[model samples]
Target: MTPLHRVGSALAIAVALSLVTACTAPAPTPSPTPTIDDSAANTPPPTPAESVAPAGGSDPTCETIIPAATVEDFESLGWSAEQDDFRVGATIIDGGLQCVWADHAGPATDHVQIFGWAPIEQDAAYDAQDNLVGEGWVREDQPDGVYITENPETTISTDENGYGMTYLFGDGWVKVADTKQGLLLVVWGD
Candidate 1:
């Protein structure tokens, strides 16, 4: 065959080989779209921040890390500690402790989360603050609790739809406090 014909044949063979390879390839699996049902619509989503397990040799627990919020603690702060309105989520992660508390009785949803770790080598406080900021909480000079002198301002109302205005907790995130264990951080939000 002429040189031109041989070149054309080689090109045709290459195209045919590619076509066969493509046709024989397995079809890609389609990823299912995540769906939220009506029941799940009201369920609060997990915090968007990726919680890092505690590092170093320190190990913390919910009991050791979370501060006690007594009935008086709630009442004095203008929050009812009644079980009906109080909900808590606490867990140990990466040898560290994380605890969250919320009063769901009101029309709005607000929560207080405390994180504790020992040794205080890394910037856990800064990380917590960054996580809260990333979650869209606006920073304030002081949390409403700080300004309360006597009784907390009562603004409770029946939330027929159960949707109330969200308020960030504490003066701000990264409330780093020194304790016997190490560093403690308190963050509050909806």
Candidate 2:
């Protein structure tokens, strides 16, 4: 072959060798992660302590779950709710009321809402990151069996270009705690 043809042939052979080497290369092994599978062991999922509600048809609110004294203390710490709306409904629990407070007076200026859940809703809370499940907020665990949102820096806005109301956590934190009485207390603030 002419020198040019020889050089071209050599390049072709080199390319072919590289392609063959790549095709034969072993794939990287994935590191195994520890996982718990109760089904495999024939063990059922552990159930949480049964939560009971207070006597009567009363609905739990933030004020109910959190003591009045505690609410005052929080207000002293710059968390103030000017107007609050409370409604008895099944938003969190059967016959439970949900409360929403708006235009808070504080450095964060956040809106607050509270919810109470029954034992039936225990699984929902455990599975949820927020007071309500599947709202885009991330769930974090506390030492006291409480599930709260991780850095819920959401803002409520009407502007479509801006973050809308669905991002309701606000520019602080949203906390949910199961009160043994089937009550889930939620607070939005710093």
Model 1 lDDT-worst window of ten = 83-92
The segments of candidate 1 whose C-alpha lies over 4 angstroms from its true place after superposition are 1-59, 66-94, 100-124, 141-190
Model 1, 95-184: lDDT tens digits are 223333234354564343223333221354345434544544333335332111111132232123322222222322221212111121
- Each prediction's TM-score versus the true structure: 0.22, 0.31
Candidate RMSDs in Å, in order, are 18.7, 17.0
What's the C-alpha lDDT at position 109 in model 2?
32
State the lDDT at 48 in candidate 1: 26
Q: Residue 39, candidate 1: how far off, in angstroms?
A: 34
- Could you tell me how far off, in angstroms, the CA of residue 34 lies in candidate 2 after the best superposition? 51
Tens digit of lDDT per residue, candidate 2, span 38-113?
Answer: 1211323123322233458555555654435445654554454332332111243343333443335433433343
Backbone clash count, each prediction separately:
5, 1
Pairs of residues at least 3 apart in sequence or in different chains that clash in candidate 2: 52-181
